[model samples]
Target: MAFELPPPLAELRTRVRAFVDDAVIPAEKAILEEDREKKRDTLNALRERTRAEGLFVPHLPKEHGGLGLGIMGMCALFREMGRSPVGAACFNCDAPDQGNMDLLLKAAAPAVRERWLAPLARGEITSGFAMTEPAPGAGADPSNLKTRATKVDGGWLIDGHKWYTTGGGDASFLIVMARTSDDPRTGATMFVVDRQADGVEHVRDVPVMSPPILQHREAELRFNSVRIGDDAVLGGVGEGFRLAQARLVPARLTHCMRWLGWADRALHMCREYVLTRESFGKTLAHHQMIQKKIADAVSGIHAGNLMTIHCASMLEQGLDKEARPYSSMAKNHVARLLCQILDDAIQMHGSLGYSEDMPFSLWYRFARSARIADGPDEVHDVVVARDFLRGALTTLV
Candidate 1:
């Protein structure tokens, strides 16, 4: 019932907020502009700053050079970092990599951890998850997997086509999901393939609505008879769905937390604007419709944060299976709210919001992608509906 963060966590949140506002936000132009060399220089400097602040990999364990904050703590801190697009990545806790680190911590064998997870947590390398495929394959639907990893001499022969493989184009390692059997749910398995491995092709980065993000770049990859030993299999054979769900449960919520920050910051900008910007007769903040927009934004953000925290609490209590529907519900609601908040903020700012003078338009594209990222809005809606339709009784509260 308590809503306050612990003293330590509160301090952590304050530090992160300052860091993002001061260091991360200012570096956006340099890190996200057309000059590739400038982007690399800015990011490298930012990474060192993060480490010096003892805030690198906040969600990871202490042993992995993180602060050891679990899911709920991560939610609090990530929201602060999420205010800016590159905030999370500044501490090496962005999507794909952050989620991949969590999965490797729980499901990866020690040897695998020693080899890949260690450096990843240290921010020495990046990773990718290859589950989505081209049309007629698994995408927004993992059950229709077409990529296969067949048993072969000394290893498994992986062959498939994957797109939207986030970060795979230049990642140091990739956790690929491939069909290993006939059953839809239990038939898949996850394998770790090094980027330099033979037969692993990095076609090109896919063009998307958002501009080239240094931290998040989607790739199209082909695994043409790529072979790897048994050591590459993560969790276990026939456990791809289980492992993926495990990673996604928290991942979906973390993404919500980070994006919530983005939307919240946008709303803050609107608040600042309305206070001084005059309308027909008075300041925009004095207008009823503007007040309504502000009110709705605060309420929606509060509701979304609560839902996300509740889902995270469930996961912290080892309620993985029971938490899926809740995660989906949170993702569905939060993702939609993110769009609404960003859109409303834009409306309040009017033409300025549409202009490049503010970050609102750029963020809108990314927020729009949230609906389809983990699973589409429709997909999560079905998940919640299916869970309830089967006669469940408990509520999140």
Candidate 2:
């Protein structure tokens, strides 16, 4: 089905696009110049401007002092923000933090929200999701979670070694996943660990391919004897797996939305370059090979966008009774297509494309990481295929 943007969303898209062209894009060079160190300084400036423009935190409700935009409107704004890699972050709508905010809003206690969510919402402090761990711990296979959180007097003792915890080093609080029960079926549980809590130690930050926007610092957290009250439990005990799934499904789709914006930008850069940059006795756009690449990139992005909107529309209308299958399909397909599009855009740009001089390399790096970060494509493929075969085989019988 062809999905259409509602009127409010359309206007939101236009406003975000203008914001990207004016405020966000101009700051990209400065960010790249100083790399990770530059983001704090740049964001300090952007935050003031975004707040003045009323473009900050569109997904958040106005009760919390945000724009109070819903799913559809936020999707449109996110796509425009994706146009500039720094766009959403500048507006305080970027991931890890955005996803963290959604979790706290959905499940955190009022006191918890006041403690963790408020500063994050106002862009005062950063947070991280400490779900991914090393080999034996929580990795691609969450079922292999090795962290242990035992009941203790007045609280729970959390002892786990979590790695690749995005935004970990700088996070004020970490939503940690640990195995709380020996019951094979319902063993996993989630606990909130404050950074200042005892036994919560930040290991070295793992360097990643992309620049650190909103401080995407992957760190190893050693929870020796960290403790928190029963209130620390998010959702409920033994519901960690279920809650994590719910948070991740929506989050994966949102990532797809943001990456679609990046893919769109990469294609636009290629289009502009091909039209002006001279090739073998002609402009690159005039060459059949270059034209085909552009066509494919456009088609890939369009298809990816449609699939994303389908899931998002259902989410908005509360029609997504169960969106696991569709969410899986959208996340996997968009990541695959985006990686392909960004690769082609880089190739079309030639050596310059591969160079840090262009954003294509950055886009490509992000595309590659997206495939593994949320869940590997192979894992999603298994999910889709298993469901499809079950339905099809039952029909055949």
- Model number with the top lDDT: 1
The clash count for each model shown is 0, 0
- Clashing pairs for model 1 are none
Q: What tens digits encode model 1's per-residue C-alpha lDDT throughout 1-397?
A: 5679999999999999999989999998888873344237787789899999999988888888999898889988999999988888888998899989988887887888899998898787889999999999998878889999999878899999999998888799999999999986789999988888999999998999987576577899999999999888998999999898888888899999998898899888998999999989899999999999999989989998998988889888888888899999889988998898888877888899988898888888867888999899999999888988886515636
lDDT of 2 by residue, 1-397 (tens): 4456667767778888887888788987786565556346776688888888888888888987688876667667888888776777888877788888888888877788788888898899888888888887778889889889999888799988989898889888889998999776689888777988888999888877865555666788888978789888888889888888778887887888888888888788888899999978999999998888888888888878877777777677775535676778889888887888888877988898889777777767756878888889889889878877776212121
Full-model lDDT, candidate 1: 0.88
Q: Which ranges in model 1 have alpha carbons more than 4 Å from their true place?
A: 34-38, 393-396
Q: lDDT score, residue 254, model 2?
A: 81
Highest TM-score, which number?
A: 1
- The total number of steric clashes, by the backbone 3 Å criterion, in model 1 comes to 0
